[model samples]
Target: MLPDFRVRQRDYLLEIARLLTEELDLEKLLARILKIAIEMLAGQAGLIALKETEGWRVATAHNIPPAFLSYLTPLLAEEKVADLDVTELNRMLKELTYTASMGLLNGTGIALAAHGQVIGVIFIFRNYADLFSANDKALLGSFAGQAAVAVHNARLYGQVNIEKQRLDALLDSAADGILILNADLTIERVNDAFERIFGRTHDQLAGTPHAEVIRWARDPIGVPLEEAITDGWPLTPNATLY
Candidate 1:
């Protein structure tokens, strides 16, 4: 039969795989990974630090009391991990361990990397010395890889959301009465200009058929603009006040 330690190790590996696949939000994923790390390795606390445009920020933490969090906030503010060389990283780790007031904490840290770029760091902390084994280090490293992918995905999602908002603002600012139509010629979006020109509210006009909208706006010449629109022609060459 396999050794009990080997069986436990397999279980831990399986759990890690499940955590990586199941969690999509980076913050929640990091929290779940840290909780697992603490439980599997007998660590007291864990912290995840991510690289931002400004500096390194704590993305997640587990089992750390509010008091410790308060103390750590200022120390981590605008902390640029990207600027640190290996020597600097080592020195910082040593200093943190030495100055930590909670207890004699033995900690392991691994950098989160993707596409050959370091994105963040994962740290596992314990109250006793020599708590981290070679196996623990290897496992944490693998977990970091998964964390990097999740963080990258989160950043990309955030960027996409920002761009969408910008595009929406641009559309709203357009002076012309712009209407977005689907394949069925149903209205999707009507801007402020549309509301003013058509004398209709967004709530009243949205989702209405394009043909119906054109019928509603009968021109001074009694021409149905819907016919021109459906024929792919301009309604008027010059601006008409009405």
Candidate 2:
């Protein structure tokens, strides 16, 4: 017979799936999952650690007392369970239990996996015996799947954002003013070079109509830029004005 908490946990797991499918930002998704996990498990603390190139980073945490977070630094840093297989994952969980026992962590730990790859781990601790039941483990495994996808997507998003920042920096360093307009002719982005050349910061010009910025200085043959993009004349000569 399943406990009432187990029944509630099943419902919560469904909610986790719904959130994972709807949320785009990984951080918020993970946070929500961790909160839900802690609530379902009745744990006092929860930590989600992501496998990084160097070490496991604490991506998100909940209910962890501030004092305990500071104390578990070494355990988190030294325990790299990234390359563990299922057998190794079981061993790692045992080790986590032993490690927690020594550090006053009375909870259950779960590994997050995707395509058989261990991407991260989650730990929940409480000050009670029978900290987790079989049903709790099953529910956590289900939630871990959703959490893994969210974590993977978040890492990819972070990488893309870093690349964009690098490209923006390079553009800002250029001598010529650059203006990026959307399909609707609305200004989307401008670099520092654009600000320097036009005496206007990107923040000031952003979302403004492109025509209001340079005033359609010149067409390809030194006519009018408004005529170029509009009448298909092409703004070739105006390129040298910057």
Which candidate achieves the best lDDT against the true structure?
2
Q: What 10-residue stretch in candidate 1 is worst by lDDT?
A: 233-242
> lDDT by residue for model 2 over 1-242, one digit each (tens)?
77786778678868866876678677887788788888878887778777777666678888665665675554456645444444554455446655756755566778888777788787777766664778788888887887777677766787898899998888888888788887667789998878887888878888898778765344445545455567553445445331
RMSD of each: 6.3, 5.5
Off by over 4 Å in 1: 1-24, 65-68, 78-82, 85-87, 173-175, 180-242
Off by over 4 Å in 2: 1-7, 17-29, 62-82, 85-90, 99-106, 114-116, 184-186, 199-242
Shift of residue 173 alpha carbon in model 1, Å: 4.1
CA lDDT scores, all candidates in order = 0.71, 0.72
Indicate the TM-score of model 2: 0.66
lDDT of 1 by residue, 124-232 (tens): 7788777567877776666667667766776676788889888778988999888877657788788889899999988898789987886644344844444555655
Clashing pairs in 1: none
